[model samples]
Target chain A: MLLSVEDFGIEFHDHDSPERVVEGVSFTLDKGEILGIVGESGSGKSMTALAIAGLLPRKKLKKEGRILFEGEDVLTMERHKLRGLQGDEICMIFQEPMTALNPTMKIGLQVEEALRIHHTEMNDAQRKERAIKWLKNVELDDPERVYESYPHQLSGGMRQRVMIAAAMVGNPQLLIADEATTALDVTVQAQIIKLLQKINKESQVAILFISHDLSLIRQISHNVLVMQNGHLVEKGAVDDIFEHPQQEYTRKLISAIPRVEL
Target chain B: MKKWLKKHKNFNFIAGAIITGVLLLTVLIGIFATPYDTTQMNVADKFAKPSFAHWMGCDNYGRDILSRVMEGMGNTFLIAVLTVLIGTVFGVIIGALCGYFGGLLDDILMRINDVLFSFPSILLALVIISLLGTGRLNVTLALGIAFIPSFARIVRSEVKKQCSLDYVKSAALMGAGHMRIIFVHILPNIMPVLLSSVMIGFNNAVLAEAGLSYLGIGVQPPAASLGRMLSEAQSFLFTAPWYAIFPGLVIVLTVLGFALLAEGTTEEE
Candidate 1:
């Protein structure tokens, strides 16, 4: 297994009574597997992603389970070790492409930054080449033009592609895409999903895809985990969950997606 | 360039730019060349009217008013620049730390900041001057320290707002350390805000330096300063009104230049 969570739970120690965000959420992701986490608003799906990546705030937070990446507990690991895993081993792409980029930095430099942070031995020229290569890999038509442009200069879909390029350039073992395509329109959304699928097949990097859309999840993910109110409601292969949902919550969620009937 | 300026649609900016540009020329010219030596006193020519020979007339000491005004402006401008430098460096550091990691560190730092901020800047500066002793360096140091809370407050607010943005989270996920995220990610985004604040700070610094000198605790004599010229001209106001009038006019113009420039630049936000 590339990643594993054993009885993993998260609670915010914000008030007199600690409020639990995620509880008893246990799952495993194998190498090159695409695991889709589906949920509604206030569901703990995004929180679980943050916990696995160690991106949660360091203050007034409580964790009550083991998150083992390569058999080493992520919760118990040193900060430096965790950082080493973050960008180099496991990368994340967020939802808002417009705000996810540094507005002042050129797209090329920002993409190059991923490689620059992990590989100290690589020269600027080498980093630049890799960045452009990844940008092209994401199928941006004019990699050179997009590379030189600022974040604000590009459209939302283009910026999302640049973001993906930056995430992929680092050659991470796991890519956690948290609502990565939700901001785009349907056409752009389909294009991004296609790009993510292609990257997964070529690179064999495990993907933890978090999204609220069941249809989008079904399109790309191999396996699925349904969440409701900070708890994992169900977990199975995509076909099994759609055709034979065992839990009422899972059935309700699957049925919520409107279908066209002849 | 023309297109960008027209997009701003701020007349205050253009007027401020023209005045500031002219003043900058005068200050630069003052460094290398002035109409007459600032210290060249002509008791016979004292209280002379504004004319081709003495465009701003002469003081009671018979010193050329125009030369003194030029030299004094340079001194005042330099002090303001140095004060702002000190404020920006220290204030940005404090603000970034408070902003990026805001649990206990924010509470502690901001409370101290509030205490410092509560004092009227001029009063705080005066207290500092009383302890540090009177000189250009000392006065600049005092004003700069006084200015820190304001810069820190603005930067802190900006950073706090930015930290909530997804880009900061993205940077963290990229294994960027605190320094990288604060300086590279957040600071660059807040430059427009910081730049305008710096401009306003410059305006305040110029006036504060003049205020200090007027009270006889800043920019010592034998060295020309706008404040010192005004103070000296007060006794001879009736004898040579131009002495006080010219220096006072320069001070107002200097302050207004920055105020207008700040308004212009602030509109970009």
Candidate 2:
């Protein structure tokens, strides 16, 4: 197993009360498999993704159980060790393409930043070459032009592609895409999903895809995990979850996917 | 630049730059040469009018008014620069730390900042100056300390705004250290906001230095300051009006220059 959570839980401390967000949730992801986590806004899907990457806010936060990445306990890992693990071993892309890259920095530098941080042994010229190669890998037309461009100079789809290239450049073992394509239009969203699948196939990198759109989840993910009100309601192959959802919450989620009959 | 000037009133930009520029040039030029000795007291020329020899006339002490004003401009400009430097460097670091990593440090530092913020900056500056004793250097340090909380507060809020943005978060996930994230990743994103804040800080610094000097505890004996000249000119208001007018005009122009420059930048945004 590449990643595993053994009865993990998260609670946020309010002034008078401690609210449980994820309760005894446990799952495992194998290398090179695309796992889908489908849930509504407050279903704890995104929180799980954050916890896996150790990105959750520490203030007013409490955690229990174990989040093991490759047999090491992530919750108790040394900060420097955790730092080394992230961006190199595991990477996460966020929702808003418009704001994911720094507006002031050129896209090329932003991508090279990842390489510069992790691959300190690699000199400037090699880092630049690697960044452009990944930019091209994302199939952006004229990667050379896109490399020098600022985040605002590109469209939403192009920016998303750039962000993906930045994330993928380090050759991370796993990619946690947290609502990554949610902000794009439907057509662009489809394109992004296809691109992600292509990247997954070409690179064989494990992916933890989090989103509310069941159809999009079905398109790219091999396995599906349905969450409801901080609980894992169902887990199975993507086809099984969609064609025959066992739990009431899972069925409702499946039924909610907008479709038009001829 | 032409398009921008046409789009906005831009009167403040032009007026502020010219006034500040002239004062700056005068002070800079004074480093090389001044018409007369600022400290030389000639009893015979005490009541001299604005002549070719002394363009701004002579003070009661017979010191050349033009020379004194030039040196005073230098003092005012130095204090302004020093105050801003102290405020921004320390303030930005403290604010970035507080905002990016909130918890005990945030509570402790921000509480201290809030206490400082509660007082009027001038009053706080006076209190600091009194504690540290008087002089141009002390006044600059005092005003710099007084300005710290506001700079910290502005940076704190702006840093908080960018803290949650994905670029910052992704940078963190990419194993970028806290210092790297704060200065490199987040700082540039908030540049426009910080720039406006620094400009406003400059205006306040210039005004505070002049005001403190006017109160008589600033830029002590022999060393001239615009405010010190104004204080001296108080007695010779009618007798040698130019003595008071020249320094007073410089102070007003410096203050207005900074204020308008700050206003213009924010307006552009």
Candidate 3:
């Protein structure tokens, strides 16, 4: 398995109550596969991804269970070891690309920073070259100009593309995209999905695509995981879940998708 | 530079630039040239009024007021700069550690900061000065220590704000260590706020140092400071009001310059 998360749970501490935010979430991602996690806003989907990346807020949060990447337990790993795994072997792309990027940083320099941190063997010139190459790979028009521009200078769609380039530049084995396309227009969303697909095909990287839109998940994901109120309601191949959802929650989710008559 | 000036079309900002520029230029000029030896005493010229020969008159000791003011400007500016450097360097390290890690360490550090903050800053500086012994170095150290809590508070809050931002979390997930995240990512973003704080700190430092010196515990005799000059002129106020006027005016100008500069920068954000 490329990545396996077993019995993962998260609890957030409140003044009077300890609320279990994510419970018994488990899944396996194979190389070059796209796994879609579908849920509404409070479904604990994002928290699960944060736990895998080890980016959960330390205070008032308690995590349980194991996340294994390449058969190594992520929860028990040393902080330094976990850090080494992040951005090198595993990377993430966030939902709001406009705010996800550092506003003051140039697009090229940001991409170069990813390479510089992970691929220390590459010299400055080589890093810059690689960053520009990644920007081109994302199919941005006038890559050089875009590279020179700051995050605020770019349009929403352009910034999202730059974010993708930065995330993928390290060639991570698995990329967790947490609602990566929710902020974009439908046309731009399609382009980003296509770009992500191309990167997955070309690099043989696994993707954990999280989104609330069932139709978008159905179109892009090979395997689907349904979550509701912090519980994993269902998990199976995309066609099986869409055609014959066993769980009532999963059936309700599938039926909730907006459709158009031909 | 002209374009930047035009973009920031605030009267206080322009006035601050002019005043602060003049004060800094006086320090630079004092380094290379002063009209008379600041410490040289001339009994015949004592308490002379402002003129070409003895501009801004002479002090009770007959030391040229203009030269002494210039020398005091240099001393005051150095102390303020040094105090700010010490405060900012130590404050940023403490604040970054507390804000970035933010658990038991934050609580402990902030409690310490709170204790420091509760005491009136001048009293804290006075206590430190008494223990460390009164001198230029001791006053600077005392003032620097006194300045730390405010800087730490500002930096801690700013760092906390930056930490909540998506970019910082993204940087951490990108394998950047805590030190790298705080310094490389968050520091630059919080700088505009920090810069304004530093300007305010400079203003406060100048005032505090003057207060310390006026109390007879700052820079010793022969080394001119605005506060020391004011102290020496207090007895001669009725006999020679000009003795206290020059240094007093300069002190007011310096404080006003930095205050306006701080206000301007804060508004820019």
Greater-DockQ candidate between 1 and 2: 2
DockQ of each: 0.80, 0.85, 0.77
Q: What is candidate 3's lDDT per residue for A117-155, written digit by digit as tens?
A: 878899988988888899999999999999899988988
Residue runs of model 3 more than 4 Å from their true location after superposition: A13-17, A57-62, B1-7
What DockQ would candidate 2 receive versus the native complex? 0.85
* Candidate 3, lDDT over the whole model: 0.90
TM-score of each: 0.97, 0.96, 0.96
TM-score of chain B of 1: 0.95
Evaluation by lDDT, superior candidate among 1 and 2 = 1
Q: B1-269, model 3: which lDDT tens digit per residue?
A: 89987887877888888999999999999988999998899999878888999889998878899998998999899999999999999999998889888888999999999999999888999999999999999999999999999999899998998887788888998999888888988898888988988998998999999999999999888899999999999999999998889899999999998898788777776
The model with the greater TM-score, 2 or 3, is 3
Candidate 3 accuracy as TM-score: 0.96
TM-score of 2: 0.96
Best first by TM-score, ranked: 1, 3, 2
Task: Give fnat for candidates 1, 2 and onward, in order.
Answer: 0.71, 0.84, 0.64
Off by over 4 Å in 2: B1-9
What digit string (tens of lDDT, one per residue) describes model 1 on residues A73-134?
88888998888888888889999998999898999988987677779899988998999899
